[model samples]
Target: MYQKKLVGVFGDPVDDNPSVVIEQVAFDYMKLPMEYLTIQVKKGDLQAAIEGLRAMNFTGINITMPHKIDVLQYLDYVADDAKIMGAVNTIYVKDGKLYGENTDGKGFMRNLRNGNVPTKGKNVVLLGAGGVARAISVELANAGVKHITVVNVIKEEGERLVELLNSKTSVEATFVFWDHKYSVPDKTDIVVNATPIGFVNKEEKPNIVYESIHPQMVVCDVIPNNMNTLFLEEAKKIGCKTFHGMQMLVNQGAIAFELWTGLEAPVQVMLEALAKVYGD
Candidate 1:
């Protein structure tokens, strides 16, 4: 019998994180000798947390919240994509060395591709300038998006993201200071709410001009637990196709599962597990 491998997600306020559930579900389904854990490492103890994982010979770890950016310094290697995004959400151990990767953006890109949503030369608008937004923007740029507009309530953060995109990639990027009911530009091809506004309250969403959503455009939100957020609902009311965060969550989880175990992830099984947990 193979020795059980230990995997865990480390973060403060870790109670609500779904990674443990989905990852453990995948491991159970595959009958892998692995244990998934939720570790509450306070922000100040992240360095110690990394060292502890190293000492424990853990198979892998998922970093979340305040640790994503800081955990980079402790890892042995970080993928180029995670370096560009300035965050690392997933890490796997190989040759006893830690490797960091950002699956958030790739998850969105994969979900879009899976749904036959094209990003090549498409004009995209992001609804926030947070960590997930950074990851998605880099992936969008690499996928040949023609333009990106980041809208945020904070001018500095939004501008920083736009600057990173414009300088680091060929994608033409701009930042918009979000105040009042921001009108979606007529030419927008895809609109994504990368913010957390809808995570807690399904009825609350980003303050965008819902009437401006065109039926031809694709709409997305990143709030996983509350999959049916008001943002996507409003887009549907406008006759536009929309989807919430379940796909992104499961896709990202699946990616991590593959990287850690070197086996094909049961994507559908993982999706069902998350859906049941969220009552989706």
Candidate 2:
């Protein structure tokens, strides 16, 4: 008899999470006797859920939403990069100790490469300065992007991210106050919306000057649930290349997949699984 291991993700509103499908499909394709679950962990209950993971011997987990930053405190040790990034999206159990790591930026880069999106020497503009934005901005800098512009409603948060990118990476980063209708610089090659604006409410979109976006720009949204957001819709109307959040989700899930099972994740199978879920 083969003993099955356990793995999953922790988030508050996990109803539409597709990572379980992505990982489970890969596990089945590889004939691995493991089970993947997406548990609904409410706000203020993260510590308890982490304790539960320890008690139940979960092989690993991916934390999302409001818990990513808070989960760091519960981990036994974290990767140095994660410490600098100030966030951890993946954790694996080793010798009953939980070790934290961040795969968000790397995963996003993989998504870009797999999608054939160009980033080298490209000026990028990020619409938010949260964990996802920070992760993507750092990787964009590492990829030798020419410059980065961080736009956020909060001055302090945006300034801190700009400072981090400028002082740490070799990328010239600047901050911009997100005016009611923020305009994308004409020279920007890549535009990313890494905010929660269209999250709980799919109908909502970020306040931006949609007309300012040029046709050659690559527009991206990290909102997993609403792949075709209003921003993307507007970008499409302008003949801009638009990218969905599912791509990032699949890539990031693949990273966690390998971390948890110590096997090369069947990315093709996971992509197909996601395609079916997304109905394409």
Please list all clashing residue pairs in model 1, or write none if there are none.
Answer: none
Tens digit of lDDT per residue, candidate 2, span 68-141?
88899999999866876889989999888999988888888887887798888899999999888998898899
Model 1: residue 80 alpha-carbon error in angstroms: 0.9
Give the winner by lDDT: 1
Worst 10-residue lDDT window, candidate 2: 271-280
**What root-mean-square deviation over C-alphas does model 1 reach?**
1.5
Q: Can you give the TM-score per candidate against the true fold?
A: 0.95, 0.84
> What is the alpha-carbon lDDT of model 2 when measured against the actual structure?
0.87
Model 1: residue 246 alpha-carbon error in angstroms: 1.4
Q: Over 4 Å off in model 2, which ranges?
A: 11-13, 39-57, 73-77, 94-97, 200-203, 275-280
Cα TM-score of candidate 1 = 0.95
Tens digits of per-residue lDDT for model 1, 37-156: 888889899989888876888989898888899999999999998998889999999998999999999999988998899999999999999999999999999999999999999999
Model 2 / residue 214 / CA error / Å: 1.9
